[model samples]
Target: MNKRKISSLLAVTCITALIVSGCGGGSGKAEDKVVSEKDYEPYSKYESPVEFTIGRNTSHTNNLPKGDSIENNMATRYVESKVNVKAKVAWETDDMDQKLSLSMTTGELPDVMLVSRTIFNQLVDNDLIEDMTEVYEKTASEGVKNIYSSYGDLLLDQVKVDGKIMGLPMTNIGNQHQLLWIRKDWLDKVGGKLPQSVDDVWNLARTFVEKDASGTGKTIGFGMNQDAMNFSPIFAAYNAFPGQWIKKDGKVVYGSVQPEMKEALADLAEHYKEGLIDKQFAVRSDEEKEALVINGQAGMLFNPWWIGYTNYKDSIKQDPKAEWVAVSAPVDENGKFKTIRQDPVGGGIVVVRKGYPHPEAIMKSINLTTDFLYSLTDDAVQYKKEHASEGLTDHSRWNNEPTQIPMQVDYDDVLKRYYDDIMKADKAGSADGIQEDRVVSYEAYQEFKQKGTAVDANTYGEYLSRIEGQREANNPNLEVIPAGFYGTTETMKLKWANLQKMEQEMMLKIIMGQASIDAFDQFVSTWKKTGGDEITQEVEEMSSR
Candidate 1:
């Protein structure tokens, strides 16, 4: 059949099936059977097994149990047993981006693919992905729906292409806030207080460099990666948020080309001139910069709170006294600690092939895994026990298909619940009223009682939660992205990357003392002439609509 005929046939079949066995009785006729809600519950197993193929990122860190492959792991087995869906791995590559691009170019995408926002948008544009509107509504459980709904209209709006939702967005909370990860031990050794302003940071970085806090005489006062010059937390101090659109005088403007950025660049240039920043930072990879922190060569780093997991874990293991703490980005002129907030839409999105037989399978799998991870049922308890030591790596990375609830989603709420309900009880040596989700926090609390700190990853994660919660609760000056900033404009696909490369080059050149600050003005002019103006105009149009 042709595409139109196939679409028409599918539409009729869907309508007929819905009328025969939907929530509402069809004309109250004897031919139609209205089922109870329990019959449609998300957790129930399929009557028979179904199968699909998918692509996956085969990271080396995914340590599966003995004799189990990614396709046949415990999590996959559990999913198959529960949902009756067997997910075969069609392809595996550590570089998901490159692999996905190759698949797209070859017109051979899997039944489902985990993809970043840009790829998802491109797939939708090419008409290679399914419109998941009906399947999601029909299959998503209350918990899964609630999680997405809590993100507000931004989640709904950004995923839509021409009024149709192209993919399911991952859910996370407050993961975008830039934090200053200061080494507390070094701070005490240098007798420097936490930075409260731009000037304070300048002074602290100078002192840290002068004091040779690394103990190897090669201390880097400010740690930075290649992307840092553009996305650095220091920009927050100057109220210049890069990689976003901001409204100024009732018009959309690109953040990187704003005047405030010039000031930030000037300040960074001064830091570089004084040797406070690593002179070779422009060439350092993320792993190398992370090592600078982990090996005690960098006194201060700027990134999100999750850096604790990526960079600090090994350092803490090697040196128990190397304490890292997350602090708010330094205060702006108004005595407010300002930081750029992320678009609430989480990482990668989940997309289905254009003519996939079982579009609802993706929704069902997400609903099942989310409930399995968060719900306190007997099965969920057993699931936790089976994978407690290895964590949820298999479920999240392999079986969940694409996205999982972000690592820091509802982090503060969970932490608050721990303190309010589980802390005192656990301190008194009782486990009553403690939920499964808070079990890890309970363990951390016990460790805190015994060792004056939570040492392991899970336990230390809880410790970081307390600090983040307290900081945000007490003082939050987060500059959130406007509703429409996250959406991609047509020109962005063609020119945004080039624009960002130009911005990074110019910004780095100024900061490295290779180009004068005057270069910023000429670059801004070139930016507008080359496509920034058109992109800004498109953003304004979208925001208005």
Candidate 2:
């Protein structure tokens, strides 16, 4: 045989020998046989039910119906019926990190759990989690595999340890960059076009404040909370991506300490001094700041497209005439709307405990759930309608699922499909071929079209977010600067917290004018001396690998 074919044959022989001899080194027990592609089925049900325990991370709001619970919800029941797999909640808490830490100490981990990147590393080092490479390859559905492959190697590479896949990385939605949400009605009243540059944004804000566009005599130019100003759209206009690791001059560098951040901070300090930003933003809670926008005291804020689904939805309800618009504005001098792109793999993963008899169960559950939610099957559509009848909204339903690994092939593509196939093709009123998860959004949009101002808050929010908000976020010209690295390093574990605290304090001080603009240089120097330089080197090494 040729060298390539011989090499592949040898590798297969070695793996078979290891499996038969039980000589491989892994936390989990050795497999009895190799599963061929022909024999393996993604959604095959077990002869008997396979039960696994999970340490669930629950939402603060218990949106489950009166008699339902995290363990007994519609998601759990559906999975059980379809795949013959049942999830028993070992323990659930809103604070999963704290509970997981305790579990590590007590040596009492669940059969499967979704954990953060830091926790995933700990589980690997302790050899408490199974090596899912083989199981995943053999049992993962084509749909799930396709989703991971869509990101190339980026998603799976995060969970690979010593060349073995230790966990399933959750693929995050792309284009999660913040957009400037403005009161378009207020802008019309002030007689200004949509902002195209940072200067334009500043001038518009000034006019909004001066004219009191809200007519409440208490209008603030920009609504901000304690941490919002640091990474706001204004900062992005200056190419300052705080909290992201971005490429600078062929090296991976922390965006927070870059020179561009200094310029952004100086500009923000000027705005704060000019009373353009909320004067009390330094002490305002998120809710308090949001209330400023909802109550018509503020005209502009920087948030993701989903802001319409949040407090801005209330803005429409409170004022039926209010018209909020999403924009990729405040571009740089070159007219490029530069924003930081999210990491491909969300820093969370689903891991199975070592010595679990049915490690493939988790893979099966992910497959079944993904198919049920997105495959547009008749059963899935019917299930969604029944759940909606019970007042179960999309916002909180997924929190009740046992295996909470979010698998999206490409959210931007999904949004594009919604825009093209549904909105452009005028199929918003049609349910044919619509996925179970997005049917409600289509329904809500239809209701908003029919009822206009009389539509409920939920319907208004849905239309605004899916239709209007996504239209802005899906801008093809918006330049997204991808983070160079997203993994945690050893030195980072020891010192990142203190370094982050130092950066946060210094950035806030500079923006609020508590410290001079020159303080940024000193902060950068101290950050490097303390741990930033070492962490950067580690990041460089990791990214290179």
Which candidate has the highest lDDT of all? 2
Clash pairs of candidate 1? none
lDDT of 2 by residue, 13-50 (tens): 44453444321222234343333443346677776777
Model 1 weakest lDDT span, ten residues long: 22-31
Each prediction's TM-score against the native? 0.79, 0.86
For residues 124-192, write the lDDT of model 1, one tens digit per residue: 655667788866676777767676776666566767776777788765555446677777888998888
lDDT of each candidate versus the true structure: 0.66, 0.74
Error of 2 at 322 (Å): 0.7
